[model samples]
Target chain A: MSTLTPTVPAKPARGLRSTEGKAPRAQRESPFARVSAMIVMGVFTLYFLVPIWWLLVAASKNRSQFNSTNPLWFADFSLFENMGNLIAYRDGVYLKWMLNSAVYAGGGALVGTIIAGMCGYALAKYNFPGRELIFNVVLGGVLVPATALALPLFLIFSQISLTNTFWSVFLPSLVSPFGVYLARIYASASVPDELIEAARLDGAGELRTFFTVSVRMMVPALVTVFLFQFVAIWNNFFLPLIMLRDETLFPVTLGLYAWNSQVNQIPVLRDYVLIGALLSIIPLIIIFLLLQRFWRNGLSAGSVK
Target chain B: MQIKKRAAAVALLTAATVVLTGCASGSTTSGGDAAACEPSEGKVDLTFTTWIPGMEDVAAVWNEENPDVQVKVQTGPNGNGGTYQNFFNQLKAGNAPDLGQIEYDALPNFRVQDGLMDLAACEGVLDAKADFVDWTWGQVNFGEEDAVYAVPQDAGPMAMFYRADLFAANNIAIPTTWEEFAVAAEAVRATGGYITNFSQSDINQFAGFVWQAGGSWFENDGENWTIDLASPESVKVADYWQDLIDRDLVSTNPPWTDEWNNAYNTGSNWTWNSAAWGANSIASGAPDTSGNWSVALSPQWAAGDNAAGNWGGSSTAVFKGSKHPYEAAQFALWLNTSDEALTMLNKSANLYPAAKSGLELPALKEGVEFYGGQAIYDVFAEASDHVSPDFIWGPTMTQVYNDTSDGFKGAVTGNGTLTDALTSAQQSTIDALEAQSIPVNK
Candidate 1:
């Protein structure tokens, strides 16, 4: 491990070119080609970034400025007032929604990641009967759209007297087949069979071997799975729209959507929706930044092995 | 080992089945979901879902007056898609609110689903009928021996609001007839202005014109519905708008959109062919244009025609699941007909009242500053009397509105004319109904 570690930093420079091409890292390329590449990337960056910039500027304006002012420029710094309105409008309902989103995403992702990891690890390492059939079924689940399941889920939840409850939303969010798929691929690649065999040889039971050895090796992969499930649950609008009736229980996305829909009826809500949207992004960005180390480790670990 | 594996799989399968059925059995299908109408201990608690804000304060006033019943308000804001769909889901679950504020057009949609209880059966609910204009009452209390399903809360009688300064500067009289309006539209366009904005996807706005032209898209005959949305009267209205659109007299941007908002706010559009609700929305949206605006009667199809149209409005309905039907009915009546309720709603909720007593309320009678001290309600009051009576809404009015709205998109996109909008929308409604084996008159 020590001998390979010193060479690892030097390895990727030579390694990437073999896969990318034998071309010497674009250094020998034309200046025109380089300039064009820079321009293309710069334009694409602006395309994605301008809307976000617009939103940041827009959240500050009141109703009249929202209508009359230039869309790209800041008319006034009424963001604090807009935030105040958003928070104070319905007795701090915006913060309640933010907390609901955190609970839904954090709780749902934590539960989803554990189940998906166990199932994926079992599928990858075990030789049980109908294992391929199970894997295939999970793969098929990845192809089915989440939206297609919501109505049926709603009907089923309704019959069970579960609709409008928090579980109706959280339970549906926990079924992330794609997360399981990623986990299976990740587990097979990251955790070697010989390590499990060694643990078994050390008088470890099946459950203990998997928990102590396999789980430790799978931490980075599981973080990736947690993030996948977290984002899916976080941005989920339609499921919550069908499931939750109480605004107090609504996730930030659904709450913002309801407010956004009311801009026509109550125009003052327009600024609130914009500010709320800008606020919704902050948590997702925070989660991403906080888990940056795990995300990077997960990506690189697969390649190095 | 093989036997153990198979047995474990079978056990798992059995457990899943048991859990599924156990969960399925929890549905309260046969009743007992909702409490009964009578007061339980001493005071009654009422729940209401509304789109209008500031209603809670009015309920607070009601609570202070009558200590026996305390009201809690729940609002869904947008009122139609999300709120109405949730209401339906709640109805199916047997947990619907006691009273729901439903739009006038959608009252039939609720009635067909048994979502509303007939207030006619609630006793003394209809006593307030004399306090409201006869037409607003007609919408809520029509069909099946004209049993009332809801009480009129507000009405949006259609009117024309224009930039008075813009018109006077351009040497235009308030265009009274459609022909004169088109001529003035060209003059306004000469100075890079629009006569008004046209919302192709807003079927409700277009329906107002069709109503003023004396067309009801749906006619009920016993068990069947006569779907005649493509009738000569509707087509005439469509043709008039299509011709103006082709001439570039009106901007074909959809309403309630950012593009339309910017254009309307900036005076790229000179007029608003709007319902009484527009007065509040415009004042809030573009406060700079407040004093420059003025109200006129909805333009006539022919010169001197007094026929007018109604647009959007909502009524307070008593749900079938309501525990306090009597209390709910009384509350609905009090909210609509009582002088205090009308004034409160007018001042706070900005509703154009449908009640006669509301006409005398100082808030309603006072000239709005946004309309340059114009008593806009005076115009709406006269327009309310001209609303064509006995307009039968269908069991699927929402479905019709959405389908027709989609059809109208083609007109704006220039894929087809408004004529196609009428025909396609009519055909779509027929196909939808016939597919369900509902009888349809061709």
Candidate 2:
């Protein structure tokens, strides 16, 4: 692919023995280069950070500040006040939503990651009959959007009497085809064949070999899968909105949306919504930052492989 | 390897046990017989669902008053009808909220769907139902006669809210008649101020205003969908608005949103068309500009127009299959139309009293501080009196309005003639109605 391109322009095709002889001088900087770069980066930074900054500022204010104060600026710091209000609102339901989200995300991601990692490792490392067909089917699953599958999932859950339960959300998160695909690519590159072959020669059972050797090698890939599934489950809204009727069962996203809708008529909820939005972003950010070291290590190992 | 398999088996069993325990706990409590809650037990868990913001105080007051029956309030998600949809799903699941808020436009939809309990079966609530304004009560009427299934929350009486300071600055008069209103708009335009703020892009509001001009969207047979869409009355209103848009006397504002709020707040437009609840949005959100604004009677279409059209209001209904029906009905009546509840509601959000007796409170008597001490409720209550009960609404109102928005935009933006726009709107409305199996005018 690299060799297909012509080295010289049509007019200069026959002029030189080596194109390296005609290297051009360093180009002069354009008049507006620095200014344009600064403008672009400025807008890009503001585009991402302005709303977040506003959220942080707005989250600190009480209901009155939300209504009366400048939206982008900090007023009297009422973060504690807002937090107190949130916890106290309707007998600490916000805390319950948070706990529910943590349970759903924590339990679902742990199980999902293990299943994806093992499946991906097997598909990549083992040369079994019908492997390609199974992989193809898993790849095909990636094409279907989650929302398109939600109604079918609901119907299935209804038949099984699992519609309004935690399992309805948990079970669906475990079947992540994209997670499997990622794990397969990572495992294929990371785990060498010699390791598996050596383990088998030592008379180690297949399950023992996977547990002691391949699974350990797949840690980074599994963690990545866990984080991906964790965020997906944490932010899950529409399915829960459709499936769950009990307020006690609601996740924070659905909970916050419920508050946001009433802000029009009940102006006081405007602050609650702003505060809720600010709090919502914290868990995801903390998770990302905490697990970033593992991600970096995964990248480096991939390069070595 | 044997040890590992055994450990996995133990872990799986633990997880299964946890799930089974959760299910067992739920089933033991609510079980197959959900309606087993006895009123005589003296402690009932009555769930009141609503989309309204300030109903908590109302529930609190009721709870405070009644030591025996406890009411638990659950609010639906804001703007999105999550609560209604959730309530509907619960109804199917046989665990519907004991009491819930219903929107006025959605009353007929609920009635037709068999989703609601017959509130006529509720013994004590029906006694107070007659005390509400007939038209307000008329909204909850499903069939020809008022076989009430829901109680009114508020009457959305519209009036012209104008920036008095801005009008004074431009020397524009608040017009009494439709002709004078057009002239006033022109004069305002000459002074470089927008005379009105309206979302001509919303055909529902357009249809609402047309209805205010004594036009019906459909005739009595319920099949003939006729509005004075292009009738002399409607065309007069449309052409008058079109002239405003063309001559730059109207601000190109969308209704009841941040854009419209900003437009009104920034003094980009001098006047807005709003209801009793509409004024609440303006006054509450813009407190600093209170003295600068005032309300006037919304300009009449001709000599005598029913100065009444609804924008939005909520109602309370008993969902079918609630466990504690009688207790739920009691709580619903108390939270919705009770004088004490309305009084509490007034303190929190200024919701207009749904109960007729509630309209006579000190809050109603005392002039509103937000409207420069103008007697706001008295004004709205008078307007609510003239609202025609004959303006019957159907289930397809929302769908028809959505389909006709493009035509409304075409007319407002001057890309099409008013007659063509309305003609297309009328046809689209019929099509939408027919799609729903709702009768349309021939």
Candidate 3:
């Protein structure tokens, strides 16, 4: 991690031919190659970064400037006003929605990630009966889209009298098929059998060995799983739209949607909707940025080993 | 083994307790409280759902007036989808609120389905049936006998709102006829900018123009359905607008979006085709553009012989599952057509009342400061009388609008010619209406 590549071609004064033979021919390279690469990467960066930049600049503008001012440039600093309006609109209901999202995402992802990790570890290390069949079934769940299952889940929840409750959303979020699949793939590759065996030999039980050793080794992968599940639950709209009838119980996505649909009729809500969209995406970006190191570590672990 | 058995037994007991408690609580409360309040009704709890603008104030007023009856205002999806879905779910669940907001076009749907209570059954309710304009009343009843599902609240009578300054600068007058209007539009385009902006992207607005031109999407002869997709009225109106787009006399943008708002606020468009409700949006959103704007009667088609038409209106209905039908009906009537209620709505958000008496209020007669002191209500009220009585909205009207709007996008956006666009839209609408089991002419 600390070493830098040797510069100046190892100072081989008499071996230019040998170095030339070893290195690929530079004559094959196109003139536009570097330029095109730079342009492509520049565009890719702009495509992502521009929206975030606009969000920051627009969030600083007051209601009037939100419509009239340049979307890309900074206007009068009114992030305070925007935040104030957001908090005070409908008597601070926006804050409640933010809190609800945090609870739903934070708690849901935590519990869901732990379950996925355990399930994945069990499938990867243990020689259980029907293991392949169960793994295949879990993979099959990924093929069926979330929207197709929402109505079925609604019906099931209604049957169990669980509709219109926190558990209706939280319970479904916990059973993420994609999370399970990713975790399983990661566990098989990242958590070595030697580590588990070492822990077991050190007088640890199966559950204790899995938790203390396997979990520590799988931290990077588990964090990746947690972040993905958290963002998914945070942005979930359709399920909450169907399940929750009470406006007070809505997550930010559904809440902002309800606000957006009315912006046409009530023009005052246009700025509010834009500002809300701007505010809601900030936490998502921050979460991704903070967790990226762990995610990258997890991705490159097997390559290093 | 003993310890394991004890834990298992404890878990089973806990699960049983949770299930029993969950089942026991909800049934016990609703029955005990809702039933207790049902007969005597001293402190009535009314759950009301609506999408009407300024409804919170109305709820506040009702709460103040009837301190004994606690009214809870629930809003559905801010637009049509939420309103329809919530209404559908509530009806299916048999737990709909006491009152629901019904649009004039959707009243027939509710009427056909037996989803509403008969408002005639409630006494001491304001007799708003006679107060509303006869056509508005007809709109509420769905042309059927003995089935009055709702009372009229407001009618959206549409007109051409033009900038007087732009017209004067262009040396043009408010065109009195459709042909003259086309010429004026051209001159305005040559002088100022885009001459006019109607939401070609909105099918309902297009249908209003088609209906005003005496083109019916469906015609019923008291027994059977008659579909008319290629009526002369339909073709003429469609062609006129398509020609306008081709000539670059109108905007290509959808209404009420950023493009539309830009055109409106910047005076890029000389005229806007809108209903009376548009006045409130204009007044509030673009306060600086006040004195430049004025209202005029819509240019009439030579065939229709009228300068006006209806676009949107709201009705108040008592849902079938309402616990307080009598109170709900009384409140519905009072809220719908009473002069006091309309006055409150108009004051808050310039909602033009459907009731004739409500429209006849001193407030309604006054000119709006926002429109260069033009008597906005007086113009709309005059237009209300000339509004085509035979503007029959079919059950598949929304579907037809969506199809036509999608089709016009190609023409307006310059992707295709008008004839081809209309043809595609006509075919799609025919398919859509047929799928909905609404009869269409071959």
TM-score of the A chain in candidate 1: the value is 0.86
Give Cα-based local distance difference scores for all models.
0.79, 0.69, 0.71
How far off is residue B129 in model 1, in Å?
2.3
Q: Candidate 3: DockQ?
A: 0.18
**How many Å off is the CA of A257 in candidate 1?**
1.3
Candidate ordering by TM-score (highest first): 1, 3, 2
What is the alpha-carbon lDDT for the whole of candidate 2? 0.69
Error of 1 at B400 (Å): 3.3
Model 3 chain B: worst 10 consecutive residues (lDDT sum):
B29-38
Going through the candidates in order, what is chain B's TM-score?
Answer: 0.88, 0.81, 0.82
Per-residue lDDT, model 2, residue A113, is 87
Compose the digit string of candidate 2's lDDT tens values, residues B269-312. Answer: 67766777677677655655777788877788765654665556
Number of clashes in model 3? Answer: 0
Candidate 1 lDDT for residue A244: 72
TM-score each candidate. 0.84, 0.78, 0.82
Query: What TM-score quantifies how close candidate 3 is to the native fold?
Result: 0.82
For model 2, residues A107-146, the per-residue Cα lDDT tens digits are 8899888888888888998899999899999999989877
Q: Show pairs that collide, candidate 3.
A: none
